[model samples]
Target chain A: MSIEGSSPKSLFDKLWERHVVVEETAEAPAVLYIDLHLIHEVTSPQAFSVLEGRGVKVRRPDKTFGTLDHSTPTLPANDRGELPYATPEAKSQVERLIENCAEHGIELLNMGDPRRGIVHVIGPELGLTQPGKTIVCGDSHTSTHGAFGALAFGIGTTEVGHVLATQCVLQRKPKSMRVVFDGLLPEGVGAKDMALAMIAQIGADGGQGYAIEFAGEAVRALSMEARMTLCNMSIEAGARFGMIAPDETTFEWLHGRDYVPKGLAWNEALADWTDLRSEIGAHFDKEVHVDATKIRPMITYGVSPDAAAPVDALAPEPHSEAEKHAADYMKFNAGKPFHDVAVDRVFIGSCTNSRLSDLREAAAVMRGRKVKEGVVALIVPGSEAVKHAAEAEKLHEVFLAAGAEWREPGCSMCIAMNGDSGKPGELVVSTSNRNFIGRQGKGVRTVLASPATAAASAIEGHIADPRPYLFAKESA
Target chain B: MSFDPIKTLTSRTVVLSQENIDTDQIIPARFLTTTVKDGLGASAFYDWRYDEDGRPKNSSVFNGVDPETHKILVAGSNFGCGSSREHAPWALADFGFRAVISSDIADIFKSNAQKNGLLPVEVDEETHKKLLASPGAQVTIDLETCEVTFGDGEKGSFPIEAFARRCLLDGVDPLGHLINQMPAIEDYERQR
Candidate 1:
């Protein structure tokens, strides 16, 4: 209630108040209008089936978009028209999605379509995810779209069908949390590192049922791409959504995107988006202040996102039973050096960290280097568009020359739905969002790191710190 | 087939002692096959159900007793911490578990549980410890009163969203609710 001189409202509170389509019972969950509904193949087949069973047509086809990811292949289809997926089961899922979206009249961004990308990536790049709107997808990483100050969260496929049918979702209001990273970030640390550091401070489940907003000088200084990387993994911190106030970086990134408002409409949209900030005296249910300068390049040694620390730090002691299990699962011993953990493979792409800028970060690290012997390094861009841009800028050459495979875009090795998985028990330094057991493959050991860290580890044959290996251009 | 409405259940609790037991551990992503919703129970906890080479792990609850017989799960705090997979609840429900009792539960998982027929009962730490200590204790969850009783008859009331409670009691989902009240909803829309 920012009625007149009422107390200053937080970012989420303001956005929440503006987007409620229906005011239901007092303190009851409200019917929130969803501005954008992103659907991907892996999670939507069941949702569409549910819709068909109910005999409902999609309510707002214009507002909904579909893309083939997760189940799509990084390698192109063979001469037989069969996708290069390990399982036909995966291929059929994406095929079902194509049919489902076509039947519903929703736009499906097929592979090799320049617009086709990770749903999260394409949503922002096409200017679909704007400030002060509500977004949902059947996938959890829909939180990635929240970087633009949108209230974005992932819903289950059941809710996905509901949103498709009504464009409105029944939701309980999430409490507000503001985590401020004050001061300047230390050198060699970027958004991914900052994300890991934040998770370290707040455990995996710390931000449950909270719409978290990042604020302060450190967050403000990040590039829009970096800010997206930060917000992308906020789900790992147990938040369905995370936001950063729309400032110059956010506006600049949105300015000329494919569908951004133009001319007077652009100016009007900008004015509205510019005001999407927490009031100076905003109330937050929980507030965490981080000394950004103290943060260093971070990495996750254990299975969960919260089992993270500074790259140079040793493995965490197993004080808790969960830690013990994670250590056992990872085949890692406490008190061992983090970087000494050898890796057999390295993957650089995901909705979490696969964009033009993320590729550039890895390219810089790979420029004058070579991937270590026996390391199967790969660079899969977030979209075909990102891949084309990287190729034009010679980032692809840089990676290829350094022995990293430049593959087509999809969620390659991210969820391992595609055939791009490392051998079982093979340790991998991956840039994907999850480090869950068997997430990459059966019994595959995953160590989550930033793109730069992943590149450096590829070159070093272990989980090496990227600070010492940053290219002069990157450091400068 | 439509889900059966779970009004009341009494059974020995299956204790899974570990915090932050994520959805992946509940059901790994690899087993997330089939657009079909029913019968994911056998695949649930696929890894925990079996050892590395494929034999069923002796320590697993699935192997120990019929999951259908033990209708309640007493897990450590922060159960279902990762991913928003509704499959987790579907699997648990397929196994005939009516409810999950935890000191804390992730927001998405709890919401997913509510939408499905599985009830989530959040007990205090002390109550959780007693339940964990006395594994197989006859825990009875009364959805009518929102109370979970076990551990020598000590009981605690867990809060449920009033809207969700009504739906669960009526054996309906949100889709069902909207369908049932379509006329009233359209009238309200027209008034607006």
Candidate 2:
């Protein structure tokens, strides 16, 4: 099992090799031990029903956690009584989740609980997600947990049922792809820009069927929040999962969290984590690198996340017939400059960017500024915890003072699953992932950007650079 | 275990000219909330074929077509591009689409479709165009030969993976394919 090279293998290679259950079995799928499983209101119902039909108890309830998001309404605290949850249809689903969690002995963070938020967000914040763990959730954004150096991925309801029944998942090991980013990012260029630039470099399917391990100096220096942002969009690049090995920054983030190891166990955990780096000269199936300094604040003009370009760069000329056809369908004029394209709305929230730091960045831009007249700007925190933290820090006040509507935490405007959506035909600057046509709502045009860019777009009523604000804030 | 591959196909083909049509749109997220047996066929193409009122739109080709008669879906490039919801293929299979003729399809969607016994025929652009132009032009996809023939005798040989072809011909799924090798597996298990 020894990798025979002097050059150290990347951390991804080491962990993956360590977890090899069966060596490429053609007759049977490999069985992998799952360390943590997170579930949400949307994808857990059918899984629970399956368990019920089988009369089986969750095999590893201790490793499972549940939360309510997606369908949870973002009504003002005062208006909770009048919200959709008050309706029978919504209430039953929410109630069923509570009952299911109780029946399975799984931890339930229902709506209104301070810990309640997007399942992905709460997993890491509470130290439930850790390095070397295999995490799966019934949500696509589950890759967000990979920021902790875990192999986290999304699963379907049936797979969720299977995991609950057996506490093991049938999996085929994926080929590994290493993505390296050199140099430091400029002030305004955040993790979202890094992810978008990577997606753009590698077409949407470049990393298909591979686990991408992000490395290099730029990635190593990123905060846990930034790393989560990088991993959240791995799915967009068509990677099964994205991960970064846990470092000092990672350990510091998990130090005193509720579910994290304590005292002697904490020291032992650190010792193990320290050994988690890749072995010397381990081989990867593929490797790609990006110059972090070359990437600018990016935005998506088309449906897929990969259809993106640097903010200052003009939209690409349609080089292929497929490109021409797709551009025509999206009504995007290729080769045309989108320099001051006005936006009808701006959204700043979702699992991708609803973090506390994300809110702070947006707040810095909104300070002493008002949202452009006639344009709707909304901010939804990713989780109830984030909402509370932001409120305590008065980030919500800053957003509200700037004429932005501050709402509760949920997956608002990210997928339009809940009722939060933009009107058709309206152009929006969003901090969420995916800009697919009607992704926000039917016919709504979305431009995915960083929170700072989204906030600046709201103030200027068009796509604009946030360099001045970010720099000024950094210096002050 | 042998099955008639041609009998698995339907008579009429419906064309959807769009690339990157996701599984979510094929079967909306709402339907995913229920069990696998709660009738996904009736809800197939729920988003694209209907308006907000749940009424079939005249603009959609699916509006007036009888479910049983329309067995093949002639789709544009990059069909089935989103979430790996097997329900997309389930709905399509349940709705009587025996085969999907597309210039391209997302890899996972194609695999899921094949596993569910829905033939995914990858045709060239020229063949796809001719098929679309002539709505009544029936294309016979022979799984045994891996060839497609239109009514005008426009014949083209398409490539399918050997494993997938074997599965389709044998009327087997991935599990079924493995089951066929049970003796060897048991022998290996005994040795272990």
Candidate 3:
């Protein structure tokens, strides 16, 4: 994107070339400067402990931001004025992050902050994420920021320490991959479905060792929230980073948000951002295309995210030992439809979903529809901001009317680290990302779906297609 | 934290051949609330190693093996996928796996493992099949030569990033390396 030469470069190449502080050599990885560093409680404590032991201050505290999500309770305090933490360790994890951020002079959005939310959700909502910036977070869903055209990816605790001490992460450039979704997505299908369908086409590890750029007609047609949903699941497909080139839609969404450049600075930022796209002949190491029209409302039938199929399709027969194990664990009959799979729990929040638009999508399906008996549905907002926005629209009333627990903002049941979990052997249809074994809880089977699909399944007490509900709403 | 230098490791392999063995399986999220890195070995593969009542399951894959003698884990293809938890490698290292040999290793896990002194050696499909077939077979992994020698005198070379190999061979922490490059990083930031 820079005026390096007439040679065309992919978006990943452009982003990579911009972030290199020192070129990689045979003996060492490249020293890549980070513009923004997002940290959460679960992974940051050890990194902070290591930094404290070294007696080193954070290299650039201004660039670092912290929040508590993974272990924070979505339920409010009880009559004793005590937050019901999952365990003493989970409570201490949150406290440690607050202390560390204070010690390092880094900005932290603490418990009472209205801006506090999931690390990935708050970043873009506050406009801290922007085009052409290199962002690193201690959470894998940090790829959500990539939908804004930032070169964002997740890092481990050691890398977290490295970033804190030096403000740069050592890295090798990942090869570029371009996944283009052709044509228009049909009604009743959404970004989560597209993500699931893409992963199903390409195995769970399809994008390994590569940085993927989601492009083409469907990607361009998506709203910022939908794009985030699509990109948030990149890690499930084994890509560390998933990005979209910034366009007018991105600029419009970010224009009035907090932390964005203003007035003359805004115009200058836009000028540079317009050049962020890959050129016509830009080369990608790998390229994949999905027929958007053929995609339907999809849900994972197995433990892995890639074990996805259309909601109306029959459950797949065990193809391998792993599949057989997954089938036995999931308790799904090979020839039966996913619709017959009973759902005991429905969770409609995570970094992957739970944006205001995602909330609206689910609320539209839940309005005037009662949740089926024995199915406990939870509607958690991704951030405090999203919660307030949805509340302003009275979306909570609709969920409450439908018998869903309208909960506070936090990861909640997604990671099951916040005392919110499905009972053992329960089947939960979740809008969150991972469905790995015991992800929701011990012996809990997780089926990943979109917010709308989750809402419909909650109403039906089974894994039902969302198209009928969506169509019924349209006609009404 | 520092790790022991791994020049050559000759040990029997502990095999768990289920493909796409994710981080959640390695160390479930429930056991991840700790701030410190120590004592995670007991919880490594917790779900697989324990029954619902919190008792150890004798039929677990890790039951028969001794951690001291079998220091290498030869797992299925696409091992360590899903979450970006470095805890996965930390748990494995604490459980006495000095190396993880697989046909395909997830990108982030490979980086995390190398930094934590748990080497991820990715072999070709044929070699992986051989490794899978011979679970406790004695294997020698030479970091200096970047090669793995396994059962029946079969051998294969594995790929590791040069910088990671250097750090592993020298027993140096990558954080220290990044800290040393701070001046260059500041220079780049100033220009921006």
Candidate 4:
């Protein structure tokens, strides 16, 4: 994408080659230096125990930061400090995170910290996520940071411990993929729709063993916030990482941030980041193209993210033998409309779509409307700063007046480990990634949708397209 | 830290004949609350391997066979496909599956399995089909030679990189390679 580069090295190759702490050999894996290592409560405890057993301190502790997200509660919507965990077991995990961070001298943004939020959300908000950095977390959604043109991906717990001890993890160079979306986006579509649409086209395993670069005019047209949402769900498509080339939009979004470079350093960084794109004739192992004009506000009906369809279309008849089983698991009868499905619970939160822009769109839908009776709608902010920012904009009043519970920021209902879940046989229209069976709760049917669709569905008490409502607002 | 080295695994196979059987299905998020790893063994494959209301299914794949008897898992393409939750490998390894035989294995899952003392062996389409036909078939995987031998002498060879093979055969993590080369790393750092 940059004009100055030659020889056509892809963005992934540029990032990977610079981070090679140890080059790969015929007999060994390459050791890549991790610029940012994120730790969370659910996956870090066992890893910390491994570190203790090995008696090795974290290498370059400054580059590592800890937060408790996946296992914390979002209840008590006030300053009650109830530590109001869903269960005693959840409490112990957070406590262990505190102990581990303290013992290891790693900084943690705990429940009470104002900066505390989902790791992916707070990382960019604080400017810890930047262009050309190699980041890793135990959660697969670490792909979220790739929006800033950084090479970020997830790793397992043993790899987590390995990075903790050495500031490096064993990795092989992934095959390169370029999925370019050309043309203008249609009305009422967003990054969430684009992501779901991508996964729908490429099967769940299509991007296996590849690092994908989401490119072209349509991807470049999105805001930084929307780009984050797009990159965040790249893992669901099975790509090791998804990236976009850093551009003016990226630099504008990152300018004057807390953790970014200052003054002279900022100008130098801006110049370097500007030149960070692939060369003119870069080659990829695989290439895919999507017409942005064709994408709709998409949602997943079956368990996998690939089971996506437009709100106007009927539930697709299962073609594969595996799809038939997926439909059966979701209890979605073939030939039924994907729309007008009844909703028992509507959750407007998750790392996938809980940012301020997400709240604005959801609140726009909730304005002058009330949630249908008997439908439990909870809108959780991604972080405390997000919570305050939304309240400052009075998004909270719109949500509360529309009969939804606006709660504190945390990873609620996404993991189902935080005591927030739909009851058995209940249908939940959620904005979270991974509608896998039992992901929300035991026997709970989950439909993955955008925040706007979730908000409209809460009011209609079923899955309804958000486009009509947004069109009404435009006309008004 | 050296754990138990895996040279061979001879056991009855349990078949999950579904493609893209993800990590979430292997171990659901609800049971991912503990730091300890033992109880996870009991809850592996909780939904399919159990009935609702917290009762174990009498005829499920896991319950029908003694956990001590079946030490191998047979699945289809894209197994362990979702979430980098090491819990998937932890649950499988804790449940005593020393090896998995599949037509294709996911990238992240293979790496996680290598470190957690679980072997992911890929076979040709014919072998996978033959393995699927026989439900209670006994299979022996020899890690030293990367060969899988069926009870009736149907043999197959799966490729393993030399470095990973040494780590698995020695029950060591790749980090051991780096730790062993600390002196060389020091020399390079000094020159820089």
Best by DockQ: 3
**Which parts of model 3 have CA positions greater than 4 angstroms off?**
A1-5, A474-476
**Cand. 1 Cα-lDDT:** 0.84
Error of 1 at A334 (Å): 2.3
Superposed on all Cα atoms, model 4 deviates from the true structure by an RMSD in Å of 2.6
Q: Between candidates 2 and 4, which one is better according to lDDT?
A: 4
Residue range A203-289, candidate 2, lDDT tens digits: 776777788888888899899999999999987777768898899999999999999999999999999888776655667899999
Predicted complex 1: CAPRI docking category:
medium
Q: What is the DockQ of candidate 1?
A: 0.51
Measured against the true structure, the TM-scores of the candidates, in listed sequence, are 0.96, 0.86, 0.98, 0.96
After TM-score superposition, the amount by which residue A60's alpha carbon in candidate 4 deviates from its true location, in angstroms, is 1.6
How large is the C-alpha RMSD of every model relative to the true structure? 2.3, 4.7, 1.5, 2.6
DockQ of each: 0.51, 0.19, 0.86, 0.65
* Model 2 chain A worst lDDT window (10 residues): A19-28
Cα displacement (Å) at residue A115, model 2 = 0.5
Best by TM-score: 3
Q: Give me the displacement of residue B68 in model 2, in angstroms.
A: 2.4
Better of 3 and 4 by TM-score: 3
Per-chain TM-score of chain B, candidate 2? 0.86
Ranked by DockQ, top first:
3, 4, 1, 2
Q: Which candidate, 2 or 3, has the higher DockQ? A: 3
By lDDT, the best candidate is 3
Which lDDT tens digits does candidate 4 get at residues A272-341?
Answer: 8887898878889999998999998898988788889887788878888788888887777678877758
